[model samples]
Each structure stands twice: as C-alpha cells, then as structure tokens.
Target: MANYYIVGLSTIIGLTILSLLYDSFDMDMYNCGSTLRNLVVTAPHDTTREFSSKNVTFDIAGKQWKDVIVLVHIQKTGGSNFGRHLKANLMLEKPCVCQRGSKVCNCSRLGSEKEQWLFSEHSVGWACGLHADWTEMINCVPSMLDKFENARQKRRYFYVTMLREPFARFLSEWQHVKRGATWFSSLHMCDGHVPTKKELPLCYKDASWAGVSLDEFLSCPFNLATNRQTRMLADLTKVGCYSSLSDAETKVKMLESAKENLRRFAFFGLTENQVDTQLLFEDTFKLKFMEDFIQRNDTNAASIKQEDLTVEQIQRIYDVNAEDFLLYDYARDLFKERVSAMRARRKRRIPS
Candidate 1:
C-alpha cells in the first residue's frame, strides 16, 4: 500500500511539472496582436493640476503614505537622474554593493544565495529610498519574509518605477552601448555568446548580438530586445532571463506577475512625460524634485532621432518587443487612470 501511495504521489508531481512545461512552450503558437486589445484597455486621460503648495496631503494606492518609497530603476530610462535627485533632496540614499565598490560589482551575480540575500536585505534596511532592480525587491522582502506577514506590515514600503517606450529605450541603450558607456560595460559584455550554464543573468551572457550591425543585431537573437521592461517588473525567480520567457507558461506567468506589480506601485511614470512625472511625484510624495538642477545636457549627442532609423529597422525593433509594447501600453493606461483620479480629487478640493 505504501509503495502504491508513493508511486501515485510521484505520478502527480510528474504530471504537474509536465503541465507547467507544456504551458511555457505553448506561448509560441499564440498571436500577440489579437490579444493586445484584451491586454491593454484604454483609460480616459486627465489634465494634471499644477502644484503651488509643499504641504499638500495626498493618498496613493488607496492609502495615505507620507514616507518610504522604493524606486525600481529600469535601465536607460532616466531613472538615474530621478534616483539621484530623490536621494540628494528628499530621501536617504541606499548603498549598492556595486556602487560602493566599483562601477559594476559582480557581487549579486557571483555571490551565493545567502550572500545575495544579505546584500539585498541590508540595502533595503539601510535606505529611506531604494533604487535597485526588481530582483532585489523579490529576494529581500518576498511575501515569505519572516519579519512581515504582508505588504501592510511594512506599510511604509511604497513602490514606484519609470518606464520608456520599448523601441526608444532599446535604441538609446544600443547607442549608449556602441559609444562604450563605461557604466553599461557589463551589460554590453553579455551581448556575446552566452554559456547555457552561466550563473549570470542571461542578458549578461548572450554575445550573438554584440559587435553586430543593426540588421545583424536583430538577426542574432532578441533576448535583450524583447520584453526587458516586463522581465524587470516580474519576480526574478520566475523570470530569470529573456531566454526563459520563450516558454509559453513562463511568459504568461511573468506577464501576469508584471501586471500585478504594476498595480501595486503607487506611482508609475513615463520618461516621455518628464515634467509631468516630476510634478506628480513631488505632489504625491510632498517632496521636491530638481527643477533648477544643472544636469549634463547631451541630448543631441546621445539621441538617435526616430526619423534616422529606416522603416525596416523600426519594424524589427517593434517586432522584437511586441510584449514590451503591450506592457508599456498597459502602463500608460494605468498612469493615465491614476493621474485622472488625482486630478479629480484636486478639483473636488477647490472651492468655486
């Protein structure tokens, strides 16, 4: 009887694994274009209110939060400038092992599970504002964290993130990399051939796209080009690298997770709306972002105008990042909804 029971249990486990694998690969067959409408329902746009006061009270995520903000800094999205401004003016700066040690520390990737956990936890505990990747958020303060039973237990933990249109971000990142931007050296390194068993994130491994022309870059692989924003938003444990997203089940799971995370964020902004983002963030947090701050304005040098890219290149970028475009569309809609709600509240407060 015991032998039969064990066999039954094993069979059930095997079936479950098989089901998951099947779901992961099944995504390849579906047409994303047909499903995009279902994915991103358009929201009514709202006019933003101009802020004049510093002491205004605001509520976000259906709750009032005055302190604590976690900024998920997506790469090449003007997140650095935002994070720096936040720390220099409003919030306590967090210590990144990479920042403290070198321009790029392989500690997170090279270290053991325990080491990574310690780094992540310490970074979170030490900062009034965290500007790390989404992976750190998942590792240190998972729902399973012993110190907190739920997100409410850490009521101060407010999440925020900024996103760019995928194609624009990709182009900017590519140009930046081509210029051999020192900060992006590690990421650039991974554009080459990736070993299947490498411990680093898959983005840090694939070399097929490195040192290639625009056409060649597209042909080599689409790992980094595809759904990076979504991957960053999803829990890292489930979404390791872009390669993992190729599995239909994993892709679905990751997309669902990203959507859920987006819902949880108190403030989601777009790079295209930098001024509005700054104002909204300040008004929401009751903290000022740099308006008079002198930043290195290398806009013309860094930017590759959309018109410069040929139709074929543009299409390739769009085709590779279909999932990201979908997520981005959803994020834009969500941002509009949140902004509209805020605008409505402010309008109601004003007396005629």
Candidate 2:
C-alpha cells in the first residue's frame, strides 16, 4: 500500500511538470495559429493578423489557383497597369495567352481552358459594363461568370483594387477629361436601375468634356469625377443612388459606406506604395509577380505641381473630394498596419 501511494504521487508530479512546460512553449504557437485562422476565416475584418504562417508554396489545386480574382478598376488609380500585370506578370503554371497589340488576354484556369480564374478588363473585357463599381460588380459578376462558362459551379471570389491619393486621383481624372477621355459607355447601374437624368445630370452637353478648364470641371455639381473613388466603392443604394440628398448627409453616409466597403475588400493596394502593395498582395494570395512594380512619379496628376495652385483652388479640390480624402486616409492607415503585421510574421519565421 505504501509503495503504491508513493508511485501514484510521483506520476502526478510528472504530469504536472509536463503540463507546465507545454503551457509555456505552446502559448505563442497557439496564438499564432489563432491569428492565421482568423486571417483566413475572417479576413479584412481582423486587421491585426493579415498573413498566414503556414507554408503557402504553390500548389496547382490550391485555393489561390482554383478560385477567381476580381479586380475593381477605379479610374486613374493605375488600374490599367495593374490589370495588365495580372494578365501577364504572375508566375503561373499556365501563363495567360496574350496577342500582340491586343488589350485582351486569355487567363483560363489550370486544367480547364473553358473556365477563367481572373475577371478583369484585360481578361473578361468589361463583361460587367465599363469600369463597374462595387455594387454592380458584386451583383453582376457571379451571374456573368456563370453565363460565360455556360454552367454553374460554386467558386470563391477574391476582390482586389487599387486606390490613389484623393487629390492626385482627382487631378488625374481632370487631366484625362481635359485630354478628351470619356466613359460615356459606363453603365452607372445601381440597385437594379440606372440613375435618371434628373438624378444624375450630365456635366457637359457635348460628346465629351474635352479641353474643359479646371474652373468649368469643378463648377459642375453632378460631375462624377468628384469623389469618384468613394462612389465607386460604396453601395449607391445607401444614398438613394444619385438622388438628391442634403450635402451634409450625403457626405457622412457616403464616406462611412465607402470605408466599410473598403474594409471588406479581400485586398487593396495604394498606387503610391507600389513596393509594399506588391509585398502585401504576394503575402495575401501566395502569388508572386515576375517583376517588381515600378513607381512612376511623373504621372499627369503629379505634373500639376502643388505650388502652381492657389490656396482657394486647393481648398475647393479638398471640399469637392472630402469623402475620397477621408477614405484614402483610412485605407492608407489600414494598409500600413497590415504590411507591418506581415513583415513581423515573416521576420519571426526566418532563422536567427
């Protein structure tokens, strides 16, 4: 009896010591696992853990390869270049087939040429109308893909986009308009209906607002160029499409809606932070770009020197794009936080 009691006591102590060691060693590992799970399960919601720790070395059957990537191309946000990159730059097992001097590319999924993995202008050719906004794309993409494939199958969609500094983007759009560019083909579909002329008045009576002065451009109250990013990102129904609302109310609701939608996106990049954008994208999707993204400081918008503008002119620009400015500020901060977290995770994984 005495020997048995001693043996039992020794067993209990050993078990307790093992539990303590495990608790000490596994606490960090457990936290990391949780973070990774949250990242995958509830991404864009949890900003703290933005990358997975698991080895994401490419697999043809992996989610990254199987699922679709939808690009919401906001105008003048370097989206055209990024879209081109998506079609031709990724190190994929089966590269997109591009024809010389053609804007379209065949980005079919691996093992099935009939099915596509990318839905963008370069691949799908504005299937959801020209430069479809979030509301239209979300509602239209799934059905459009089904129609394109001529069959229905469940597939995950990871929406991505690029955002630029508000004032820069605004100026870029103004420059583009000045150069005779027009998106008159753009179907501003919202809530299953297009805005009527009464709701969305044209800024110009001519075919295009070409050679328009800055004063004329800003004078148009219904100019889509104003707060273009925010409107493109937000669900238009929230503010009754293009229906009239008090200026104060419109600003508040639109800005909040835009921010919320931005947070929900699978991934977004800033035009200014090309390097970090590439890194964040690679980390998020486990895909690599063949070449580094080059930053261009000599864009049309960048050419308009800040010193060249008057104080009131600058103030008007800000006032017109107030919502976009707020949205960009939020996006910039969130982007930084996500990049920092990814870097820290990568650094920890390296051998010391």
Each candidate's TM vs. the true structure?
A: 0.58, 0.83
lDDT string, candidate 2, 185-279, tens digits:
88999889988988888899999999998888888899988889988998778888878532656656666667666765667999999999999
Best-matching candidate per lDDT:
2
lDDT of 1 by residue, 1-352 (tens): 1122232344334433544554433232112233322222221111111122223233322133212355677767777666555544433122224356433321211222112112122233322123334555544443333343223333234467889877667776666545544232222111233224334343334433355456655653434545678777876565554345566566666765676567655566787777667666765665555353443335532456656767667666766555566577678887776677567767988998
Q: What is the C-alpha lDDT of each candidate?
A: 0.49, 0.76
Number of the predicted model whose TM-score against the real structure is largest = 2
Give candidate 2 regions above 4 Å deviation.
1-66
Worst 10 residues of 2 by lDDT: 22-31
Candidate 1 global CA lDDT score = 0.49
Model 2: per-residue Cα lDDT at residue 138: 83
Local lDDT at 169 for model 2: 90
- How does candidate 1 fare on TM-score? 0.58
Stretches > 4 Å off in candidate 1: 1-67, 91-132, 141-155, 181-212, 239-243, 290-302
